[model samples]
Target: MKVGLYFGSFNPIHVGHLVIANHMAEYSDLDQVWFVVTPHNPFKKKNSLLDDYQRLEMVYRATKDYTKLKPSDIEFKLPQPNYTINTLAYLQDKYANFEFALIMGEDNLKSFHKWKNYDVILENHHVYVYPRISGNHIETQFDNHTKIHHIDAPVMELSSTFIRKAIKAGKNVKPMLPEFVWEYLDEMNFYK
Candidate 1:
């Protein structure tokens, strides 16, 4: 099985994430797109993030109906300050039968050089980059690299940070997320 690992904090899963994951599963070579919920991303500020379990529940609620998409808690059991390279290495070892690829936004690709052992990641696994609204100026390096794949998944201007701000301001962010997930958020009084 070929899987595209879509890693994120998923502080609260939203439609943008679903759309991209669906696009990858539908238009790309990946058979499955797993939402690997990171407990703590070294690149992100951890204080504002929801609990890892809460984020996982939201991911599950947001993606439950989509068979090709799955919510993964793989990072929850791993070490803190999750690193993509480490997770990729671990997944490669554990799921020897399944081929894994990294799914990320073009913006991330621009900053890819800063990641730990990025060369190893590009060498070992495929990378599928979806375009982002703010990164049109960024040029993809290693254009001739065999494992890098640039795909045209729809660009979603919406972001999880905006969604959280909306929710905290007592605004309804239902349109930004799957209905089930919004309902779950309401029930839990999350981000209050």
Candidate 2:
């Protein structure tokens, strides 16, 4: 099976994420898109993130109805400061039958070189990059081995940090996340 691994913290899985994953699965050769919920990203600030389990649960709840979309806790069991290269290696070893590709926004591609063993990652895996406001200039820097495809997924200005700020300010996030996920967030008093 060809799977596109969409990795993120997903503090609260939003519609924009769902749309992009669905778009990748429907438009590309991928059979499924797995939301690999990262426990902790090496490049991001740890203080700004929620618990890994909580983020995974929100992703699970938000994508429950979609069989094509799955929430994976693969990174939860892996070592801290999750890196894409390591995760790819682990997944390849664990699921030998599955062919995986990296799914990410073009914005991330701009700083791709900063990642650990990025050259190996580019050589081994396919990357499906969606259009973003930034990172267009970095497209020409990719080598022949790095398969980068541009997608037309809708752009959403929302981010997990914005959602957290809204919740902390007692603002409504109903428009930002799915109904069930918002209920879970409210019930647990998360982001309070």
Question: Distance (Å) between predicted and true CA of 131, model 1?
Answer: 0.4
- What does the lDDT come to for candidate 1? 0.88
Q: What ranges in model 1 sit over 4 Å off? A: 41-47, 135-137
Which sections of candidate 2 miss by over 4 Å? 41-48, 134-140, 143-146
**TM-score of model 2 (CA atoms):** 0.89
Model 1: per-residue Cα lDDT over 134-189, one tens digit each = 74646767566788888888899998899988988999788998999899989988
Model 2 weakest lDDT span, ten residues long: 137-146
